[model samples]
Target: MSVQRSWVIGAADCYNKNNVGLLIRKTACTLKPDVIISVDGDIIKIRSESTFKNHDTIFKLNEEFDEVTADGRKTKTTVTLDDGVLVQHQKWNGKESKINREAKDDQMVTTCIIGDIKAVRIFTKKN
Candidate 1:
């Protein structure tokens, strides 16, 4: 979407944190985080605020990059968008995770999956 949008957590489900890694665990615990997304051409920037810290990531579409997660783990990250859906893939330490985000009305719904453990976070778009 070529525009900056602010989003706030409207709902989340992250109960079984033990099934995932530290990064996902922290996210599971931070149920009500805030996020701001800026999309400009092929580049997308995402800034998120959690209970403990604020994280910012900037990446171009379909490009793979190295990302050190908030839990201090180094991971390879790639982001792509297709058919109005944004997908992110992460790999590290022989583990992998996928995240999908799509806009439904005025809300951005994100589904995070690591193995069979899935966490859903819904954010309401603002302004």
Candidate 2:
């Protein structure tokens, strides 16, 4: 039998913003190749490899508001990528935000914000 390498990646409530009490914990694991696979959870995955030369990853967040807007107008926001790419703009249909990228060390420290609230998704290129 052949052995397979797997990584158990997870975070504790210690890192969660809502778990101030540290009572709630979340965890997950996956093989390196499975990085391209999507999972049903709030977690984001990043992978690195020689053949690929770079890693691509995305994170999404969705939230619903009591009202679409204070003035009853649809709220919209634009997102800019590290490459100076204006990926997309969002309008109030139950706000969904996403961050995507082709990994590069310099891009790791780069970021974008939606309105006044900073996005929680972060991708770092591996050296």
Name the candidate that leads on lDDT: 1
Model 2's alpha-carbon lDDT is 0.30
Residue pairs of candidate 1 with colliding backbone atoms: none
TM-score on alpha carbons, each prediction: 0.85, 0.25
Kindly give the number of clashing pairs for every candidate.
0, 0
Tens digit per residue, CA lDDT, model 2, 36-111: 3233475333333323233433333233222222123354544333353324344566754433333332332212
Model 1 misses residue 92 by how many Å? 0.5
The residue-level lDDT of candidate 2 at 56 comes to 37
For model 1, how does the per-residue alpha-carbon lDDT over 1-127 read when each residue is reduced to its tens digit?
6225889989988746545577667655765778898977877888888777788888998899988765666889998886777888999989999888888888999898888878788899876
Task: Evaluate residue 51 in candidate 1 and report its C-alpha lDDT on the 0 to 100 scale.
Answer: 76
Model 1: residue 87 alpha-carbon error in angstroms: 0.3
